[model samples]
Target: MKYQPIDSQLFIKNRKNFASKMKSNSLAVFNSNDIYPISADSTMPFQQHRDIFYLSGVDQEESVLVIFPDCPKANHREILFLKETNDHIAVWEGEKLTKEAALKTSGIKTVYWLKDMEKIMFELMTQCDTVYINTNEHYRANVETETREDRFTKWLKERYPAHQVAKSNPILQRLRSVKDPIEIDLMQKACNITEKGIRRLLNFIKPGIWEYEIEAELMHEFLRNRSKGFAYTPIVASGNNANVLHYIQNNQQCQAGELILLDVGAEYANYSSDLTRTIPVSGKYSERQKAVYNAVNRVKNEATKMLVPGTLWADYHVEVGKLMTSELLGLGLLDKADVQNENPDWPAYKKYFMHGTSHHIGLDTHDYGILTEPMQANMVFTVEPGIYIPDEGFGIRLEDDVVIQENGEPFNLMGSIPIEADEIEDIMNS
Candidate 1:
């Protein structure tokens, strides 16, 4: 791992919190993500399953965690199963975690080789009446691959159909939504790294530069700061390309006097930080570009203030729509007649400003949080509002990661990164 090892106390506290929510006599399971294959003798990078990483701080493959708070034996209450390391394997693949290292990493004293999992879990399962299965239930989830957790769930069910089964995702969704202090610090670090990347681009961006070059600059900054690069696939769209919401083919040449919409973030210790900043390729925005940029910035600012505790997700977006409507009307994108004749399903502002105003962000770019539920303190969200004007040949999106506060307005984590029109202009021209 390029990032330093996280404090195991975070995992300890997470496990304790999760254990408290488990049903009586129930055991929960978590599995590490598979090292996926690309072809013979080639494999995609190993990415640890977020849930397993959340619970155990074990960032390696072929690992499992089981928690049975009701177990009679103290050691069996929390157990970690790691792939055993041998001399030949160590020589070929580098050293795996020693048992002592695993204990330090996870704060679990009981460690067993992967070979012993079935025998030990069978004994523990007999003692527990219910089992908790992990699943991907994030609102944006569109998984097609049968994950490691899925295979384990199938095996567990087939082996013990008589046991009552429960979903762990619901419990995790609620818990992970509320950030731990350490998790917040890690997220802050990721945001800080993103800020470095953005600031570097502010000086480097110029006419005729390739969009991919900007992506490379950001990746360079992130890696030097001990990050594993972007939290998600970066979008370095310029001009008309920015109109495409998920544009990631950063192969276009940034023409002079065109706007570049950079939607990117750095990932530190597997925690994500999302940021979007639209700027001029030539370091100076045209009058129309500046107008659209300010409008989107205004919407982002107002929308961020609405992310207070108890704020409903649907209602918040509705309020943001109203805010955008007023801005679009001011910009003459929508006149009185346009507003009057617009359908309720898709408002007049939809032509200029589309996409949700915000989304939960953390370990995953779109992290787990129940949308229907009210916003709470310590919950991090991305306030991103954009105006895509294809006819005008420019798009503007302003996004900032913010933490909902217990009182007053939510705190912007990227607050000091410079988003205002004048501020961005000064930085680029300086």
Candidate 2:
């Protein structure tokens, strides 16, 4: 891991909070994500499962965490199972976590090697009446690949058919949505890294630079800042490519007058920050481009204010749609008749600004929040509003990550990054 070690107290608090919510005589288990393979000898980079990292702060693969609040044996109550590390293995593949290291990484003291997992789990199963299984139930999830969690769940169910099964996703969704002070600081670090990338691009961007070149610059900045790079697949769409909502080709040469829609962010300590900004390729927006950019920025600013305590995610988006509609009308993209005759399901603003204005942002880019529930203090969300005009040959988007406050407006995490058209232009021209 490129990032520094997180304070174990954060994970200790997270485990305590989660354990408090578990049913009596129940044990919850979380597994590290498998290292996926590409071909014969190559494999994809290992990413620890966010849930396990949240609770245990163990960032290595082939690890497991078990939380049993009512265990008869005190040492078995909280346990970690890790791949055994030896001197020979260390020489070949770098050092895996030593038992002592695992204890330091995670606050859990009872650590076991993977070779002893079956024997330990068998004993644990006999003691607990209920088992909590983790699953991906995020609102936007469309997972087709069976994950390590799924395989563990299948085996657990088949092995202990009589045990009462419970879903951990619901509890995790609620718990992970609200940020702890430590989590908020980690996310802020990620946003700070993203800010560095954006500031670098302001001076580097010029006519004839390839979109991929811009992506490279951001990657370089993120790596140097102890970030593992982009939180998601970056979008460096130039010109008409921005009209395609998820354009990531980033192969085109930037033209003098076109706008580049950069939907990019950096990750630190497994926390994610999402940001989107549109800027002129030539370092100066035309009159029409300036108008559209400001309109999108205005919509983003207004939408961020609505992310207060007690606001519903769905209701907030509806309100944001109205703000976008008003901006679109002022931009001449929508008229009174367009709104009046528009379908309720597809608002008039859909023509120019289609995507949702905000989403939960934290451990994952699209983090785990139950949208039906009311927003709460310390919950982080991204306020992104975009206007795509194919006819005008450009698209504009402005986004910022914010923390909902109990009083006043949400706190903008990316406030230090320049967003105003004049500020961006000034930095570029300087």
Candidate 3:
């Protein structure tokens, strides 16, 4: 692991919070993600399932975590099932977590090898009346692959058909939405690393530089800062490429007078930080570009203030749209006729800013939080507002990660990362 070991107290508290939500006599299960295959003898990098990692801090393959607070045996209350690591595995694939090490990493005393899962779980199942199954019920989740957790769910239900089944997603959706202080610290670390990457690009970007070259610079900075790399596919769009959301084909060369839109973030210790900043390829924004850039930055700042506790997700966006609408009107992108005649479902501002203004961001770039529920303190979200103008051959977006505070406005994690047009211009020329 490139990152330092997190204090297990975070996982211990997380497990306690989760277990408290389970129905009495219910056993909850979480499985590690599979090392997906690419081709014969080749595999994608092993990524631990976020739920398991959140609960146990076991960042490895073929691991399982079970929580049964009211278990007959006290030692079985919280258990970890890991792959048995031996001398051969140590010499070949490097050493896996030892039993003693797992105890320190997870704060769970009982650890078993994968081979004993069936025998032990079957015995424990008899003592419990319900099973809490982990599922992907995230609003944006569109999974096609059968995950290891999914496979285990199918097998668990078949083997224990008599037991009542409960969904862990709902419980987790609420618990994980509210950030623990430790989790917030980790996210702050991610944002700090992201700041380093963006600062590097501000100096490195120049006319005639390929878009991929900028991506390389960001990756280099992230890796050296103990980040694995991007939280999502990075978008290093230069000039008109910025008009296309999710544009990742970073092969085009930046021109002297064009702007490059970077929608990228770094992941540190599995926590994510999302950031977007559009800057000039030639180190100076045109008069028109500066206006659009300032407008987007203003919208981003105002939208962040609305992230305070008790704000409804849907209502907050509607308010953000109003702010964007006002900006667009000032820029003449929308006229009185456009505003009055626009469809209520798709507002006039949608013409320029189509996607969402913000999303819950943490473990995943789009983290879990129920949209229907009112926002709460400690919830982290991204404040991103953009204006994409293909006709003008440039697009502007400004984004930052923020945490909703108990009082007043949300705190910007990327506050120190220069976003003002003048500041960016000064840094670029320096």
Clash pairs detected, candidate 3: none
Model 3: worst 10 consecutive residues (lDDT sum) = 300-309
Q: 59 in model 2: Cα distance from truth in Å?
A: 0.6
**TM agreement with the true structure for every prediction:** 0.99, 0.99, 0.99
Model 2, TM vs. native: 0.99
Residue range with the least summed lDDT across 10 consecutive positions in model 2: 298-307
Residue-level lDDT tens digits of model 3 in 205-276:
998999999999999999999999998999999999999998999999999999999999999999999999
Q: Name the lDDT value of residue 62 in candidate 1.
A: 96
Q: What is the lDDT of residue 158 in candidate 3?
A: 91
Stretches of candidate 1 off by over 4 Å are none
